[model samples]
Target: MDNWEEVHEKWTSFQNLDPSLKKELDHLAGDKKKLEDAFYKELTFGTGGLRGVLGPGINRMNIYTVRKAVNGLAQYLKENTVNVYDRGVAISYDSRYMSQEFALETAKVLGAYGIRSYVFDELHPTPALSFAVRNLGTAAGVMITASHNPPEYNGFKVYNEDGGQITPAEASEIITFIQQTENELTVPYLERSELDNKELLNWIGEEIDNAYLEELAQISRLDDDGIKREKDLPIVFTPLHGTALELVTKGLRQLNFTNVDVVKEQAAPDPEFSTVDSPNPEEHQAFTMAIEEGKKSNADVLIGTDPDADRLGVAAKDDAGKYRVLTGNQLGSLLLDYILSHSDKAILTNGRLIKTIVTSELGRKIAAKYGVETIDTLTGFKFIGEKIRQFDATGETFVFGYEESYGYLISSFARDKDAVQAAILACEMAYYWNKQGKTLHDALHDLFEKHGFYLEGMSSLTLKGKEGSEKIAAIMESIRKEPLAEIAGLKVLEVEDYLSGERTFPENGSVEKIKLPNENVVKYKLDNDCWVCLRPSGTEPKIKCYFGVCSSSNQESVETLESLKTEMENVMNQV
Candidate 1:
C-alpha cells in the first residue's frame, strides 16, 4: 500500500474495469512517474466536492471513484436525512467527457443502497440541477461537471436539500464516510436493469425543465412596455458548447426579445468543447466566435455562458462603438444597479446584497445608494446561498448576489448561481440603458463619475502534480508565518487570516475575530482603499490572487492595481 506498484497491482486485479481502462492500466505500466502521480493520493473531497482529471485510479474521476463518493453520500443521507427513501437524490450532468456515465454511476451507486434517484435524461446546466433538487423535494442533488474547466477535467458537486452546495460540515462528514467505506476498485454500483426493476431509477427531463424555467422567469423584471419597445435590440449569445443553449435563448424569447441571435457554431453540446480554447465564459477568448457574430449582426450586446452554464460573460459597445468585454465586477455592478433602479424604494431599503469578500467594492457602493446593506461571505456562492436561507427569519430581502468569477443569483428559486437568470438580466439591462440613450459602458462610466472609481482584478498561477501541491502549501505557510507590512508602497493596515479566524489591525495592535468559517485565505487591507487576497483554488491546481482598488479616477485605480499585482507576484515567487 505504500508504493505505486502495490496500488497498480490492486487496480489491475479489478475484473470489472472497462476494456479501455484495462488497456490504459497496461499502457501506464512503463511510466513510473505517471503511476505514482495517479496513485500517490486520492482526490480530496471538500466543499466543492470531487474534481480532478478524467482517468482511471482513485485520484481521478473514473466510475470507481464516483461510485465510492456516491456510496458515501448515500450513507450520509441514510444516517441524517429523514425519510431518506422518499427524499432521494436528483442527478444531472453536463456535456463533459464521461459526464453522463458519471451521472449514471452516481445513480447506480445510490440505487444500490435502496435510495431512489431522478437522473436527467441528458445534460443540463448546474443551476437547473440545483433547482431540480428543490423542485423534486429531494434529500440532495449531484451534478457531474467541472464547470468551466478544460476537456480533460470532470467533477462531482454535491448539494443539500435546499439546493445549495453542501456546507463544510456536511462535506467533512461525507468525506469521512468516503474514506471509511471507499475501496475504490471494489465500490458497488448497481446495473441499470436492476435499478429500473427496483423502481429506484427515474429519468427526468422536460417536467423539471418547465418548472425550473418557470421559476427562472419569475426573476425577470421586464415590463411589457419595455420589452415591446426594445424587443428588437440586437443581442448575440453563445452557450460555448455546453448546456445553456436552450434555456438562455428560450428565456429571452419568453421575455419577447425577438432580435436575439445565437452563435450557431458554438450552440450545441459538444463534450470536447472544440470551439474555444477553454469553455470559461469569464475569458474574452471564449467569446471569439460570439463577438464575430455580434459585429456581423450589429448586435448591441453579447452574452455567453460557461459549459455548466453557472457563469455568464458579457460584452458591450464602448463609447467609440467598439465591442468590449465587461469584467465580472462591472457586470455585477451593472446588474445590481439595474435591478435596484427597477425596484420600489421600500423594497430597496429592506433588501440585502450578498457578495464574496473578494468581489469588487463597486457592488457595495451601488447597493449603498439604495440604502441597501452589503454582506460579505467567503469566496463561494454557497455561502451566499446560506445567507438567503437565513433571510426567512431575519426579515431581510435577498436582492441580488454575485461572485467575481461571473457567478450570479438574482432570485432564491435556484440556490446556485444562474447564468440563465443573468443572461436575461444583462440583456434587459442593456435594453434599458439603450432606451435612455446609453450603453452598459456608458452606465459604468456614469457610475464611476458619481461614486468614484473602483477596479478589481485576479490572476492564478498553475502548478501541477504532487510537487505543485507541496509548493502551494509552502507558499501559504510562508505567508502566514511572516506577514507583509506593505505592498506596492502602501502600508498594510490590517491582515485578515481566515484560516485563524482573526483580523489584526497593525496600526492599533488589536486583533478581532472573523465570524466566518476558517479557511486558508490571507487578505491584506492597505492604507488606501485597496486590498489583496490570496487562496488556493478549491477545484483547480492553482493559487489565486485577488486585487481591489478605489480612487478618484480610473487611471489611478488601474495603475495601483498593476503595482499591487507586481508586488504580489514578487512575494509569491520568493515564497
Candidate 2:
C-alpha cells in the first residue's frame, strides 16, 4: 500500500485510536510534509527492536504499533518456544513518556495471546530487564527504552532467553511476524483487568534488582574490604532524569561506597529530560548538572548514565581543576585495563575481551600486553553479547565487552551493557587509584603515558524524516562507490565492508569473508592503527562517523584525530 493510503486507513478507519493520537492526526492533516513523514514507512522492527518518536500515525511509536509488535512476538513465541505459556516473557520499561503505558500494552497484547508476562512494578534500568529474563527463566524479554535518544523518542528492545539482545536470526523471524500484522489495530490485545483475570501478568520488584546487584558484586574486582577501603572516595553521579537512580545508588551502597553523591536536579525520573538538549551521555550537554555537582563537592570523579542505564559517561578533574569528560573509548580502555591489570592472569587461559569494530584499538593493544586475545564484532553490543554466548558454549571465558558509545559489560550474566556494574567498578577504580594519590584523570594519563596516547572521536549528522533517511542511504552508497584510500595522510591498507561481507586489502587486493553478521557499515583500516568508519545509526536518523588514532604524544593523537574526523566529514558532505 502507498504511504497516503496507510495514513487514510489510520485517519479514517481506525476509530478506536487513542484520543491523543487522534488529535495528533488532526493536527498534521494540513501539513503534507508532516503527514508524509509520519506515514511514509513503518518504524523498523530492527534486530534489537522498535524505536521512534512517540506520536500518532502508523510509523510513530504508539499503542497500535506496540501492540502489533507484541502480538507478533506472541505469534513468534507460540510457534518457536516450547511450553510457551509456562515459559512466559519478561517486560520492563524506563522512565520515558508513555513508557509504562507501552509496557502495560505489551503485557496486554501478550496476554491476549495466552503468553505470560512478568513485568516490573516500576521503571528500571535496561540491564535489570536483561537479568530478569534469565532470573525469571522466561522465554524472552522486552525493554521499553530509547536509551540515550532525545525526549521525543522511545523504543522497545527484545532479548532472547539467553538474557542477551535477540540475535539477527531471531529478530528476522520476529520481524516477519510483525510485518504480517498489516494493520496495527488488528493485533490481538487484552485489557488490564482481563490480563489479571487470565493470570498472565506478574509484577516484579526489588527481587530482580537484588539479584542483578549481587551478580555485579560478584564480578567486581573489589570485595567488601576493597569497597570499604574505597568507601570514602568522592564521586558524583546523575541518572539524567531516568530510571537509574535507585538501583545504582543501592548498588553503590551495597558495595559500601560511602561518599557517593547524586546530582540532585537530574536524579529524579523526568521523561522530558528537561535539563539537557539530548540525554545522551556521549554528548557534553548531558553532563552539565553533573559537572556542577562535581565541582561543588570537590568530587574526584563524575559519572552519568543515560536513561535506562545501559551507557555510562565519566568525567574527572584535570590539573586546571576543570572536569574533562572522557570519551567512551578512553573510559572503556581504562576499565579494560583496570579489570585486567588487577586480575589473576593464570585464570585467563580462555579469557577474551569482546568489543565492536568501531571501538578503539587501545583495548586490543591493552589486551595484548596482558596476553589476552580480543574479538571484534559488529557495532552493536548485541554482537558482543552474541560473542559471550558463543564463548560460553565453547568453554571460553568472557572477560569484558564494550562499545565506544559509552556502553560496557563486565559480567556476562546480564548479557547487555550494565551501567550500574560499570559505575561500581569506576568508583572502585577511582578509590583504589585515589588512595595512591591519583585521581581518575591521573590514572587515565598514566595509561596514555604507559601505552601511548590513544584518541578517538565521533561525529553525527542528524537529518530527520523520510528525505533525511534517503539522503543517509545515498551517503552510505557514495562511500561504498568511492572508498577512501587514505585518511589524513595515513594509507587505508584494508577495508572491512560488513554490508559486502568481505574484508579486502588495498595493496594485494586480497579478500576474505567477514565472520560477523552483515550490517550496513564500512570501516577503513589505516597504517599506524588509525581508521575511520561510516554507518547510519541503527536507532536514530543520523549518519555516524568514528575516528581513532594512537600516537606517542597527546598532541599527535589529537591532531591526527582532528585531521581524520575533518577529512571524513568532508568525504561524507561531498556524498
Clashes of 1: 0
Off by more than 4 A, model 2: 228-230
TM-score of 1: 0.98
Kindly list the per-residue Cα lDDT of model 1 for residues 31-52, writing each as its tens digit: 9889888888888887969999
**Collision pairs in model 2:** none
Per-residue lDDT of model 2, residues 117-193, tens digit only:
99999999999999998898999999999998888889999999989999999999999998888778777788889
Displacement of residue 91 (Cα, Å) in model 1 is: 0.5
RMSD of each: 1.2, 1.4
Q: Give the whole-model CA lDDT for all candidates, comma-separated.
A: 0.90, 0.88
Residue ranges of candidate 1 with Cα displaced over 4 Å: 227-230
lDDT of 2: 0.88
TM per candidate:
0.98, 0.98
